[model samples]
Target chain A: MFYREAGEFKTSYVDDNQTFPIRFDRYRYYFVLFAAFLVIPFAVNDYWVNAVFMPFLIYSIAAIGLNILVGYCGQVSLGTGGFMAVGAYACYKLMTAMPEVNIFFHVLMAGGITAMVGMAFGLPSLRIKGFYLAVATLAAQFFLVWLFNKVPWFYNYSASGQISAPERTVFGIAVTGANTSAWASYMFCLVFVFICGILARNLTRGTQGRKWMAIRDMDIAAEIIGVDPLKSKLSAFAVSSFFIGVSGALFFSVYLGAVEVGEAFGITKSFLVLFMVIIGGLGSIFGSFAGAAFLVLLPVLLKNVLVGMLGWPTDLAAHLEFMIVGAMIIIFLIAEPHGLAQLWRVAKEKLRLWPFPH
Target chain B: MSNEEGYVTADGRKIGGTLMEMKNITLRFGGVKAITDISFDIKEGEIRAIIGPNGAGKSSMLNVISGFYVPQEGEVWFKGAKRPQMRPYQVAQQGIARTFQNIALFEGMSVLDNVMTGRLNYMKSNILHQAMWKGKAEKEEVENREAVEKIIDFLEIQSIRKTPVARLPYGLKKRVELARALAAEPMLLLLDEPMAGMNVEEKEDMSRFILDVNDEFGTTIALIEHDMGVVMDLSDRVVVMDYGKKIGDGTPDEVRSNQDVIDAYLGVSHD
Candidate 1:
């Protein structure tokens, strides 16, 4: 009864096209945002922040980016790790080069740099598609990793070839480096995630998002109806990389504190983000968060239950984690191709049609 | 059929000058000739039709006109300017919109969203404005939405506006495709088999909508169809083709009386 839209007549186009048109949905969204922004930081400790919240928040951004390119634009990319590495290294370089600038600016500028690199890789997409495009992005992944590793310039000629985030503060509170508190880093990442989430949501619901979907659904017809493939595709790549880059910057600088390009931003990182998009739901913003949270929490929950509670071996828990993830991905693909989002939609539809079985 | 003759249709609309002209177009695919030395012009305010049997290259002619296939020898003239070699999107931007023969609606998108995509060329807000969705972007979006809603109402697709195109019936999907094409508000509309697979009732509804679109909006139309009755009743002029070559070009009655068209239709041995 509470979920009905019976009398909520939209008087204008702006009112009709809102991100959450339902009153219940809008309130729930605001409640979630409030809890994330206000309640979580005050109540949570380091363990909760490090093990669950930070990774979930950071990876959600990456998932949204990949979903835009892979799900909405229909460009399969396996080089997300490489692009993330670009972001990390770019953030590192910018932090070191511009010590006086704001750390937030450094994070955004890192995203911008990764966008250019991402677009460079996205050029092959116009000429290739499907599995071929995936391979092309894989090439980008390998090439980017190798370039970052072999080139000492990216690492500032360090002996270990690892780029580390120096102490950076926002509003005089350290948000990066080993000296920072967990809450400070959490708030920092949370703010960026909030902005990125809103921006991604709005972009996907608007004309730009429709253009990407049009190209994804039917390129030839999209072209005949006036969607420029080059512009639409490259814009997807650019915007997707921007978010991935920001997430990477946060992952390395704020979350990880230090990273070697090979081990941290490896090919497996790309697969992890791809799995998040696939298992969460393709072409949905909420699916990105759902998938990221599910993946992040599953590993932790497994470790806690299997290793901590049941006294199982750590190695066995890790192995079991892989098996569970693999099985879930296959099941999600075969059973409900739209992943968690479709399930959510079905549940909502049933709720709306309550007491009437049709 | 002189080029200068301005014929008035029964609805009292004057068929204006040439909207789109194709001269001596020749399209070849490797060793196969899809269209050879074909010429046709769509008047500014008339419904033109191309009728032929299977493999007559009617689709190929439309493709050539829409810039999907580049002809080896021909000039495409639109509104008095010689059209340059361009992409399909460029042609669309030049005020030419078309529906596909296979109903190429974006199956993943809602009917409303699919129609809204046709306004992409019209909505020019930059990325920043769109992402922020304030001022110019919001205003342009509302403006476009109003226009798209008008087209939806015109097509009588309001009930299924929120439904995905994939979930729609075949006839509704075709109507949705028409809605998408009409949303572009093009000067010249190309319909590739608008009634390819439909019942008689659906065909009648589609014909009425097409005629209404032409009469109300004054849009010039060029459609490729196989239904003889619907084609003859709807189109002001008919271009008859067989085996990649034009056999007759005139009003429906003239083409119907032509010996070559009758022979082509009756499967008479041309050799």
Candidate 2:
């Protein structure tokens, strides 16, 4: 009953075009944001922060990036892992080269660098599309990982192939490195997540989003009606890679603390993020979060339930988790191809009409 | 209707001079010629129709006008400027908008969003501004929304503003396509078989919208249609094509009286 928009009227176009036009949705979103920023960090400890929240937030960023390309702009890409590696490597290079610069700027710049890389890779998209484009990006994935692994300069000519994050602080509070507190790192990633979420939502609802969607839904019609395919596709790539890069930077410096490129951002990483986008719902920012949350929590939940509570072997539980994820992907594809975001929308839609069926 | 003073409709709306001219536009696909030496000029503030039997290259002519298929040899003149070889989008940027023969609505978006897409060329804020969604981008978005809302209102699709284009009926989809083209606020609007699958009432509504668009906005319109009644009633002038050649081009009555036009329409044995 509380979800209804019965008497709540929008007075202007500005009001109508809000990300959450309904008063209830707007307030609920504010409450979620409040909990995420003000409440969650206080209650959560290291285990929850490191194991659950960080991966969810970081993967949500990557998924949002992928969704913009594959979902919004209809460009299927398999190079997410490679692009993320670019971000990670770029961040690594910048962190070592300029020890004095803020980590925030480094992360943003890493994203910028990845955007250029993404645009360059996106050049082939203008000529090839669909499966061919996916295969092209798959090449990007393999090539990027291989490049990072083979290039010693990327690792600062270290004896080992691993590149580790040095101690970094913001306002005297350590957000990265071995000495960092759980809450500081959590808050840092949380801030990026919040900002990125807002930026993505804003971009998708405006002109850029329209152009991308127009290109996605019907490229010929879009081009004929004045959307430049090159701009839209490349912009999608640039924007998507920017987010992916940011996530990758955070993935390395803040989340992982050290990375061997092949082990960390492998092909599976690409598929994992793709799974999040597919299971979450393509083309939806909220879906990115939903997919990330579901996938992130699944393994944890399975470990506790299947291994801890049920006394199953660890290997068996891991195998079962894989099976469950595979089954979930299949079920989601067959049943609700739009993913959890669409389910949430339908649920909310029904809630709006609760207690009375038309 | 035409004189030394320039053409005027019976309703006394003055049709202006040539807005777009096609000079010897010959489009070929491989060894086959689609359009051969077809020349036509569309006057400003008038509805021009291209009509022919199946395989007469009518759609091909529309494609040439919209820049989907660049002619092998010809020049397109727009408002007295000789248009160079350009992509379809560049042509759209040059104040031309069109609907496809098969309703090409962006099926994934709401009616409002699909129509808003037509406002893309006018939306100038960069991605940075768009991401922030405050100040410049917000102001531009709101202003363009105002313009789009007007087109939505004009087309009377206010009720289904937020409905996805895929969910709408075929008739409404055609109207949505028109609304999208209109959202561009082009100097010239092209409609490809707008009433192809419409019922009697829907066709009348579309015809009225076409007339009102011309009367109110003074938009130059070029259309391809199979419905002879629609062609004769809605168009100020008609171009009849047969076998990739312009058989007749004149006022509807003049074309109706042409003997060659009769043979093309009624079919005559050539073999």
Q: Write the per-residue lDDT of candidate 1 for residues A1-358, one digit (tens) a residue.
A: 5578888999999999888899989999999989988899999999999999999999999999999999999999999999999999999999999999999999999999999999999999999999999999999999999999999999999999999899999999999988899899999999998999889987888899999999999999999999999999999999999999999999999999999998999999999999999888999999999999988998899789889999989998889988986787787789988888888889898888786747
Over all chains combined, what TM-score does candidate 2 have?
0.98
- Chain B alone vs. reference chain B, TM-score for every model: 0.97, 0.97
Looking at candidate 1, what is the lDDT of residue A55? 99
Question: Across residues A160-233, which tens digit of lDDT does each residue of candidate 2 receive?
Answer: 99999999989989888999989899999999999899999999999999999999999999999899999999
| lDDT (Cα, tens digit) per residue for candidate 2, span B1-271 | 5443358776677888889889999999999999999888998899999998899999999898888898999989999889998899999999999999998989999999999999988999999999999999999999999999999999999999999899999999999999999999999999999999889999999999999999899899999999999899999889999989999998999999999999988878889
- Candidate 2: clashing residue pairs, number: 0
The DockQ for candidate 2, computed on C-alphas, is 0.91
Mark the 10 consecutive residues where model 2 chain B has the least summed lDDT. B1-10
Instruction: For model 1, name the residue pairs that clash.
Output: none
Please give the lDDT score at residue A37 for candidate 2: 90
